[model samples]
Target: MSDSPENDSIDYGNLMHDALRLLIRNVLTDVSENGLPGDHHFFITFDTNHPDARLADWLNDRYPGEMTVVVQHWFENLDVGDDGFSITLNFGDQPEPLFIPWDSLVTFVDPSVEFGLRFEHHSDDDDDHDPDPENDEIPEAPMEENAEDDTPHEAEVVSLDAFRK
Candidate 1:
């Protein structure tokens, strides 16, 4: 057998994915603790099934496995502690609370500047976790939320169509 270090592989891709998640979490933590400074908003999508996820009964019912949250206008009580973040978001004219730990997060998208990151599913076992029961191919959640608060979801959903020009 040939001796090659490449044969004993390292998953640099997964490592990078984990690092990106931490970076996203840090940004969210900063924004939550201190108001997002001039023209900064985020689009965060996460798996609802990961053990650390928290959502309203209705939201959990609608999106049992995953959901995307807009960190723009109308969000309140933005608090980020050691484990995760807790914020109040409006759902169909009614405000609901949500809490999401970093681990539950499966993807993060910052449409503000044409950037996005997708994470491995719970099944990937990047860090020793059992596979989630939910189906992995379920469609992604919508990019926006229906809420009365004006938190600036706009920054998270600008026109990429401009790039086509």
Candidate 2:
């Protein structure tokens, strides 16, 4: 692809990445408002140290700066606002409060659909100041049991006569 005079300065690659992140955010926001329907579930992972992140002191003590939470049957009090959303979930055995801004979200995964998205935070210059994974203590990815896990039968081999012919 040749860069024209006007197109030379635009970085389309990064722009598309940003767009994809936005799309994921929109999906989450919708889910937050309308509630998850049927078997759909989300694994939301976010940077806990990001300026906009809010968490109970105890949760911070245990999780430090990053955590991945499952949005499932247990979550309650889901309040989504313009800047962020607040939800109450059982942390350990006690209910804990958390507030997470959209910008703080680093990754989102839907195990049912085998889909996910990752985002990076950047400064005004669009240069990423990498998150201190050590300082923030990136949490281990949570394991999700999808339909395949429960139904462990092998695929039945049915001869495809149409293709063979």
| Reference-based lDDT, each prediction | 0.61, 0.60
In model 2, state the lDDT of residue 48.
Answer: 68
Q: For residues 95-153, what per-residue lDDT tens digits would candidate 2 score against the true structure?
A: 98889876666666666664555454443453443334323222335422211111111
C-alpha RMSD of each candidate structure in angstroms: 10.4, 13.5
What are the per-residue Cα lDDT tens digits for candidate 1 across 10-113? Answer: 76655665576567768877887788777666667666665667887778878766688877777999887767788898877899998887666645665566
- Weakest lDDT window of 10 consecutive positions for candidate 1: 148-157
Q: What clash count goes with each model?
A: 6, 0
